[model samples]
Target: MLTALKEETYKFCHEKIALLGLLVLLVTTLYSTLTKTINKSTLIFAFGAIEWIPVIIIAVGAAFFEMEYDNKTIVMLLYKNSSKLKIYLAKFLVVFCYSIALALGAILLTFLLSLLTVPGQYHWLAYYQGHTILTNLLLNLFGAVIYCFFIVGLSFMLIMLVKANTVVICIGLVLAYFGASFSTALMHTFPTAVGILKWNPLNMIFISQQLTRGSFALKSNLTNFQLIIATVVYGIIFGLLGYYLFKRRRV
Candidate 1:
């Protein structure tokens, strides 16, 4: 298992795709850091920075990493004494870690750079705006881990099931941005769309915004208990399905 993990990590590290993702994440972090202001204009930029980091990581991991398998390289690992389970774990682990790292890196860099560039400049925001440097850092850091895991894991599962990476990437990005909005737009016309919105990952982003601003989080009213339960159920089902697909795929 360790050997499999090491090999997978090495492969991911060497990929130009992974490097580019890291680079983009860092650049965005630096940009956000240098311009730390609170306004409607910055709101769009903030969301764009945060949203694109995960979307890019998820797209790359979903669409490109599996190319090696499609070209028969994955099968070669079997001859190297790697079990199907280990192989699946290795691949999943690499992508999962990659996603988490990119997300956290961007968030931390933004927070740190914001401090360096505009000390006490973000004071117009909510809770963190008035807090100490370490306090703000801690808040964002804790929030990042909880939120990153679910989003990245959810997208990684989708990538695992879809055979065509490019198609999945395009569709995933479209869904990433417009899915919740479209679903909400249809909620009144199509009641079932409301149910679909319950599980939409974009809701998590909205939930975070509400919580950070000291407003009522949509999930907090217990109005979303069913959605939360359904999400947990759906996540388990898909994760197992991903594992099954990886283990059973024929060369």
Candidate 2:
């Protein structure tokens, strides 16, 4: 496992697409933060810079999985690792870590931009939405961590099953942006199955919203804790299923 993880990390670091994706994420973060006219620094701090996180995650995740198949490297990886599960997990872990790194980068850049662009505008201790700016930021980041796991797992599973990077990326982007909205619409349209539909993976995307503002629970019909649990559960399910498919796939 350790060997597989090291190789995976090294490969990811050397990938041009990974570096380009990081650059794009940083640029978009800056653009999103600077373009917002709202003076609410806390809101800008938590959300503005992270607006492109899901898109980047989807793109990078698709590329990571597809690259192995495209380059015919999976045969070598399978021969070297002996354990398909280890290889799959190592790749997933590398992508998951990349997602966390993106989040941290966004947070750091948002803070620095806030300082340089609007000096004294942000108050870490100042309350916003019933919590301090710093508190809200942390909560949002925590939610983002869970979201990353869910999305990355979903991405890996989709790529393994579809074997098409473009299609996987498109599906992922749509879900990242509209999954919550679609889930809401479903619940409304089929009001009788709200209980089961509320637990759907799509609805779990609202964990961040509910965590940042308790009022969002009314819309999600779930508490922050419930959302967190559901998201984690779905993430694990996808990861296991992806591994199963990867193990059974023809080399």
Indicate which candidate wins on lDDT: 2
Residue 249 lDDT (model 1): 64
TM-score of every prediction relative to native: 0.71, 0.94
Model 2 regions more than 4 Å off? 41-47
**Looking at candidate 1, what is the lDDT of residue 15?**
76
Question: What does the lDDT read for residue 12 in candidate 1?
Answer: 79
Candidate 1 residues 1-251, lDDT tens each?
A: 99989998887787788888877777765565455554432432342355565566566666444767766776677889557778666766777677667656655565555556555665534444455434444444334334444544555566666677676667657756775566455454665555564555445443323323444333332233443454445445555677676666666
Residue pairs that clash (backbone atoms under 3 angstroms), model 1: none
Lowest summed lDDT over 10 consecutive residues: which window, candidate 1?
A: 215-224
